[model samples]
Target: MTRAAIVGIGQTEFSKASGRSELQLAAEAVLAALDDAGLTAADVDGLITFTLDGSDEVGVTRCLGIPDLKYTSRIPQGGAASVASIFHAMSAVMAGVCDVVVVWRAMNERSQFRFGQPIARGNIPAGGGSSFMEWCLPFGAQSPASWEALTAQAYMHRYGATNEDFGLVSVLLRKHAATNPQAWFYGKPITLEDHQASRWIVAPSLRLLDCCQESDGGVAVVIAREDRARDLKQTPVTIHGAVTTLPFNHEIISDYYHGHDLAQLPMAQRVAARLKDLTGMSPPDTQVAMIYDNFTPQILMQLEAYGYCGHGEAKDYIRDGNLELDGSSPLSPNGGHIGEGYIHGMNLITEGVRQARGTAANQVANVKTVFLASGVAGAIIGAG
Candidate 1:
């Protein structure tokens, strides 16, 4: 199939929530992206969003004053479906299904609805405990932090790694966030000592500093056929490859028995290798990586999965300062989910675009490609 590329992107300021309706947030983000692409609402032929997304496709279209639409779809898997939003949009454009596709997400997850809190407040459904809901919450795994703790501890036991190793990640991201004006942690740099001293949310694995802050904001991207992208005003970023993998018997957080070996996220490893093969991209060829960091541990795991390091070697690799901006493999330039507002990895994707455009607050020199690791709706994007 012919390829699709991103020609423009847009995002609202990250915050707890602006009191704007979800529909309004969606329209604002979509219109901003279209404007950035030098296109109008009338130019968008398709729309894509999350299945869990509050705003329906028709609702957003009308709010944005879009006159017509030819295609629309939704992807599911919570935050894992984020990059997949782009994957679906781009695929449609490439297959002659739609010409101009808008990939967007808008939510008030923080201000109005707190996903991190227990769900019992709203009254539990009768289906009962076996739901992804029951899998963790019933067993003291109230939040992602507690869930990650299981895997983090297992990894440490297998590799003889320590809390200091995990602390290194927080130190690096906070440092980068300090330099990022738009990041929520702007001008805030936490040292390893600070990381060590932080409160433990789940113990041995996640700290108050290791988990991402809940954010209420929206983001959108404009995608078109690669051939048509050249006519646009901005530099075109091709969708080199896109893939999503569901780990066998995947639970919301840690399926310990199935994923007992912390170093073995075979699903991620397989997809990374496939994307590399499809794009002819080696780990060294990329200039930046926009990895999804719902938790600090996942960042380390992704690095190893992508062949950046051998299994159980992320501890040493991270300790050597390789993930620093000037170092070999810079992890997140926009503070990631830690320093930057967490939009379910959508912020990371935007940072990837900024790096490719040479406009990031902490821009790495000569960026040509970016590998984005999104944790929304079971989707991933590799664009450059």
Candidate 2:
């Protein structure tokens, strides 16, 4: 299969604005990507996105007034599919099925639809949010915070990660975001006390600061054959190797009793193994790490499972400043979801492209491989 590269990238301001609908946000990003790619929307033949994205393929195409002719698809597994959208696009492009593919995600979640809040028990809820919500919602598992608590509790029970260790993870990301101007929490650094004292949305796992923002925005990218990308306006971020894995018994989020460990995102290990094989690279050579940050502990779990550190050693490793921007191997120097705007994991996706293109605000020197991880544990890696 031929290699695919990101030729262009675009996004709207990350905020709680709902003046524009999801479709309009998506269209804005799409049009910007097309222009950046030196291609017209008429050149787009395929569309890709996550299952959670508000804009459908036809809806985005019609809104943009693009004369699309061929492919369209949505990757499932929630926010985990953010970078996977690019992987799917690469596969399609390599197979000669589509030429210029646009991957986009749009959500008016902050205004019309909010995400980081509790479901109304006395009111309507989304379709898939039934059983689990029913069981935990009344018990104050009212939000994502509560659901993650069960797993974090289990992880702490099994191993010995303390609140300090967990604090280190958020601290590192917040510090990283402090230097990133795009971060909403930019210039704000949190102490361990700051994290600990934050209001408890879910005790023992998530706090007010522990969760991601309720964001409403959109992002899109244009991808094409690697050979064709260098001829465009900017340097292209190549797809070195991208894989998607959903472990057995994986649900949307809840995995506490499913025979899965909270300190382990099995999918990260799977993706790491595949990445090792595909790129013929090792962990030490890894320059950056960008995993999903739905909750801080998830990153801790992923760091261990991906073997950045041994099992039960991630918390310690992070405490030593291993995951900071100028540390051993930086993870999400661009604020991640917790600090950066949450357009799903699209921010991470764009950060990966920026790193590969050497345009990142906190650009890592001598960078070759850019590991762009996503999921609600979706992990994907790309390069230029």
Candidate 3:
């Protein structure tokens, strides 16, 4: 099969308030990525983004002055659609539906509406509501934090994992972010003690530090046919594998209804298996991971689902220093969404590209393959 490569990556400065429209953020990222690839808007033929993105593709195309668009689409898994957006772009290029595809995600999550706030009944966007939300909303499981708290508590009870265990993941990622000028917490590395001392957000399981901050930002990447990418300005990061999974009956953030096991992430596990099957590479072959850290427990759950460790072994994995930059698998070397600004995990994609190109602020050594999982989907990008 013909391949696709991410040739350029661009992102706006992550902040609590961008002070700009989502459309402007999207356009800036798109133009910056094109510039990085040494290409112009005229070279693009496809546009892909999250279904919830405030910017429309038609509006973005006009902003970029792209002559025409052969493919433009959106996927609706909310924040979990991050990796899937790249997968869709690769599929489009491979199928010859488009030549140069740009995947972007822009949001004013903090400045405009906060995702952490409780939503009124029926407020969930189209195709976003389910029996799950209906059942939980009336009973105070309104915010995303509240909905996931049930699952997080279940996992904690099952694994004997404590709040301190979750806090360590937060501490470690903040350490990585401290050195990264682009991170929202760039100079604010925290200690395990700091994490433990933080106030609780959802009682015993989650603390203020465990939750990811809402940020206003945009991130965009340029994907091109592999052959043409080799002639571009930067070393092309090859898309080795990509997969999106909603195994059997899995819900977006609240999958308690049917996740095979509430303690596990079935969608992530399915995506992990598909990615390994497609690439013939597993976690051992992975040197860097940019897993989504929307919440601390989600990071632990995804690590286990990705086969980085056995069920309930993520605590041990972290204690063994495996998540550090000098550790076996340097998880979230760029601080992930927790310490880095959250742009719906789109920032992780660009960080993965930087790792593959040996240009990251917190570069991992000889990082041939970087693993990415946005909870519901995953993809592996390798240096070619």
Candidate 4:
């Protein structure tokens, strides 16, 4: 089988307002990634992005003046689409459908729109928006915070975890972001008290500090065949394993309807199993974990789901300082989505690449493997 690797990574500044159109942000990020790869627009033959992205391939192609494209695709499922984009790119490269594939995500989430806001029923196009929204919005579970809280209540009840326990996840991520120059919260570390004092977005589970930032930014990466990546500008991060698992009856972020325990992330478990089967590596084997942090509870749940700890033990695992830079599992040294800007989890992918290359802002020592998990999707990136 052919192999694929990430050759370049680029992103615009993380900000509350980028003061530019989403298209311009996309173009800039794509160009920056191509430049980082020592490749030109003409070198790109494939493009992939999220269905939620406002900038389409034609718009980005026109802006970059790419001669032509042989393959193009859009992945859905919100934040899960981040790693899934890599899965598609790797498949395309391995299958010889394209030579150089650029995956990008650009948005003015804070400036132009807000994902944290409640979705009006009338605003949702008939049969177009998420099916989960239909079951949630009517019951005052309108926003992401509300839905997460509703689902997280089960875990807190089952494991006797407190809000402060979840707050610790925010505190640690903020600490990491404090030292990370690219993070939005750089040099702004917060304490457990600060996390507790923040206004509750969802009482009992989520606080303002616990929620990830809705930032205006763009992130892009270039993927190529391993043989081609060897000649690229940066140390290529090989795609050892890329897998996305959407288990039956599972909803997107608020996966309550699944016939399993709400405290457990079935999709993440499936992804972990698939990754180990594909690459013979598990979460404990990796030096770094880039788990998505749309909310604090997610980190804890995924910590358990990814086999870092046993069931109901993630709170203790996190409290033991295992998520720190020098700990057993240094998590998202780039501050993750909590401290870093949330480019809908795309920034996490770039951070994974940096870790594999030993060039991250908060570089972990001897990082041979980096694991990226976005609830339903997960991938193992190995240093090349």
Using lDDT as the measure, which candidate wins?
4
Q: What is the C-alpha lDDT of each candidate?
A: 0.77, 0.77, 0.88, 0.91
Which ten contiguous residues of candidate 3 have the minimum total lDDT?
122-131
Model 1: residues with Cα > 4 Å off, grouped in runs = 121-130, 257-260, 375-384
Between candidates 1 and 4, name the one with more favorable TM-score. 4
**Over the stretch 1-384, how does candidate 3's per-residue lDDT look in tens digits?**
789999999989999889999999999999999999988999999999987899998889989999999999998777888899889999999998888999999989999879788876845444643546767777877887877788899999999999999998999999999999999999999999999999988877889899988999999999999998999999999999888876666777778778367999878878887887899987557899888888899989988988989999999999999999999999777888889988998999999999999999999988899987898888999989
* TM-score, ranked from best to worst: 4, 3, 2, 1
lDDT of 4: 0.91
Q: What is the lDDT of residue 37 in candidate 3?
A: 92
Local accuracy of candidate 2 as per-residue lDDT tens digits, 60-128 = 878888785588887876677787787789889999988788999988778887687777572244443
lDDT of 2 at 139: 69
| Pairs of residues clashing in candidate 3 | none
Point to the candidate with the largest TM-score: 4
Model 4 CA lDDT for position 75: 89
Separately for all candidates shown, the number of backbone clashes (residues 3 or more apart, or on different chains) is 12, 5, 0, 0
